[model samples]
Target: MTKILLHGCCGKMGRVISELSKKYDNLSIVAGIDKFGSDNMGYPVFKSLDECNVEYDVLLDFSRADALENLLTFSLKKQKPIVLCSTGYTEDQLQLIENKSKELPIFRSANMSVGINLISMLLRKVAPVLKDNFDIEIIEEHHNQKVDAPSGTALLLADSIKNSLDTETEYVYGRSGSSKRDKNEIGIHAIRGGSIVGNHDVIFAGDGEVIKFTHNALSREVFAVGALKACQYISKVSENKLYNMEDVIGLDF
Candidate 1:
């Protein structure tokens, strides 16, 4: 069994991942770290990662940006692989993740949904081909408590689209009045509401037709499963490597 230390154990995402851990025979969650003193569905929750005595095979971070530094430091010190499911990292924080990836097996993704990652790959392929006549726009919806806008998935899709295009693509957040989109602009929109798990849409608008691809995640367990799969892959992969869902899923096209 691959032992894991799950951060943010008190949050909704963490809770779902914990429950899903029970369903996988090859995976076992050994310890949990949370800011709140709340126990994780019966596991002893530590107030900080520093207090944990047990050694785990991997660390799964679903915590906030503020907590990331500590987790990264811990992972580096322990020389363990890490799977990051948190979002809203600033440029400096991203640089840190990039730097950390140089020494440890790190899998960082904003959205852990396999479907969404596939959408990212698909967008890269479709964006450039459709760029001539189509205007691309991205829309993402999440739960009310979600703190990020445009979402990690939205940004991932945007970056994939940008990478595929020969020219640099500009990202335009929701527009104001009297504003028009440039041919090179990729519009990203965000919607937050109650109890929505996750939804992302990429639309290509043309003169006579519209092409759309959407991925809707109805349960947090889907992400948990993805994270688990990532952890499994991480165990076998070498250090100083960065990977994503595409790498884990082994999708070449």
Candidate 2:
């Protein structure tokens, strides 16, 4: 069995991963780490990694970026692969992750949904062809309780569009100020309200026609499932590299 130590085990996505992991015979969650320190389930829940005594193959982290330092340190000490599902990382933390990728296996994705990763692939293919005449904008929506705006997924989509642009593109957050849109500008807008699971739309507009690609996440299970699949994949791999959703789904970019 591929044993897992789940971070953020008490949170929404963490609970989802905990529940869904049981459906797979080869995968099991052996322990969990949550700030809330509640484990109604049979597994032990620790407040921090240093307190955990149980054995696990890989760590699946859905915790916040602030928790990365301790978690990354412990994972490195254990020589274990980790599926880091947290967003809102600082630039220094991201750089730290890149440096650690050379020492241990690390899996991180802007979005865990398989469909979203495929959307990233689609954006890459379509962006180059449409950039000259089309104006691009990215709009993302999430639940009001979410802490981050212009979600990691939104940035992922914007990055996809930016990579294909021949000219340097400026990222415009919102149209609050009174100014006309620039040709080299990529607008990213965030919407927060209700209990929205997730939604992303990338629009390309021209004089005559407009094209928009959208993905709607109806349930949190999509992300949970994707992370579990990635967990299973990473548990088996011996290579020390930073894997993305593409690595789990057998796609490039």
Instruction: Name the TM-score of candidate 2.
Output: 0.97
- Candidate 2's C-alpha runs over 4 A off are none
Candidate 1 weakest ten by summed lDDT: 35-44
Residues 1-253 of candidate 2 have per-residue lDDT tens digits of 8999999999999888888887899989999998789849568999888899999999999989899888889999999999999999888988999999999999999899999999998998999898889999999999999998879999998988788667799999987767788989899999999999999999999989999999999999999999999998999998899999888889654
lDDT of 1 by residue, 58-128 (tens): 89988887888898899999999999989999999999889889989899887888888888888888887
Q: TM-scores of the models, in the given order?
A: 0.96, 0.97
Predicted structure with the largest lDDT when compared to the true one: 2
- The Cα local distance difference test for each model comes to 0.88, 0.91
